[model samples]
Target: LRETRSYTWGLVIPDLTNFGFASIARSLEAHCREAGIQLLIACSEDDPALEQRVVDNLISRQVDGLIVASSGHSDDIYARIHDRLPVVQLDRHIGESRLPMVISDACKATAELVRDMASECGAEIYYFGGLLDLSPSRHRLAGYELGLHRAGLEADPARVRHRDYQPSSGYQLMAELVAELGAPPRGLFTASFTLLEGV
Candidate 1:
């Protein structure tokens, strides 16, 4: 019998204030500690350039592996790190880069939320924030559509306002939904936690 040990891993996340990513980081840190491996954590503030710098810094620190919470411009960073080391994508996946990923079932959750909104409130739903270029937003939208269909409602592309996931963008999108949909959507789905706060 052989005793298994954890490997030192570097975690690059979007923001520390991001509860979802933080929760994942905290869990991973505990796991690493238990396994006697060091965990290095870095935050990018959703900036690709910053992410790249952090990745370089972490690599230089001689971490055994890496985990990145994907964000805009992350694809480029992943591309740069693709073969240099073994990297896991936490919370987002890169198809071409072949990075292992752990993420929420956004598609399933979206469908469920939309269905609930439709059934409970007969409420028109509008998903705001984040361009489809991002993973979570896209999956959530797909889920929203599924939920709409389940509720015997149709999706109106106009109702969905995709933009940078920010407080200002959410506020603007909310305004648009109010004007275009003839009312604010009874249910609003936001892509990022900050966007959720904005709403």
Candidate 2:
């Protein structure tokens, strides 16, 4: 059998300050300790250049595997690493890399939740989403639209806002919506917990 103690894995994440990512890191650390493996982790702060740098550093360290929560498209970097060692993507993924991924089906789940809200509220539904460029954000927005369609409601472009997945952006978007409509929508969906906190 392969010696567990001889194995080390590199984990690269966008931001550890985000509660969800921090929790995943903590759980992975615990699991690694139990499995007698060394874990090396890096935070990219949601910058693609920093993410690449961290990945390069990990590659130099000769880790056996890599787990990345990509900040943006880095298929080339990941493809290079995949040729050397196994790579698994977590959460967000680079475009069309075909890497093994573990990501939440936020799209379907969010759609269902929005549908339920719309059914109960019997009013227009608004979506407050994250960065439009990010896959998760795009998925959630698509889900929101699908949910509205399923609920027999038209998706109004004016009622949708895509912003950074930050509390400040959420607050600002919500403020703008209220200023324009004079009241909040009866049904509202926020893509992230941080954004929800802002709302």
Q: Which candidate tops TM-score? A: 2
Over 1-199, each residue of candidate 2 has an lDDT whose tens digit, in order, gives 3553337899998777677888999999889989877889999877888888998898788788999988776578787778878899998867887989999997899878888888887547888888787788888998988888788888889878887878888899899988888998787888987788788
TM-score of candidate 2 relative to the true fold: 0.90
What's the residue-level lDDT of 168 in candidate 1? Answer: 74
Per-model TM-score, in order, reads 0.83, 0.90
Error of 1 at 84 (Å): 4.6
Candidates' C-alpha lDDT:
0.77, 0.84
The list of candidate 1 runs beyond 4 A from truth reads 1-7, 72-84, 175-184
Instruction: Tell me the deviation in Å of residue 43 in model 2.
Output: 1.5
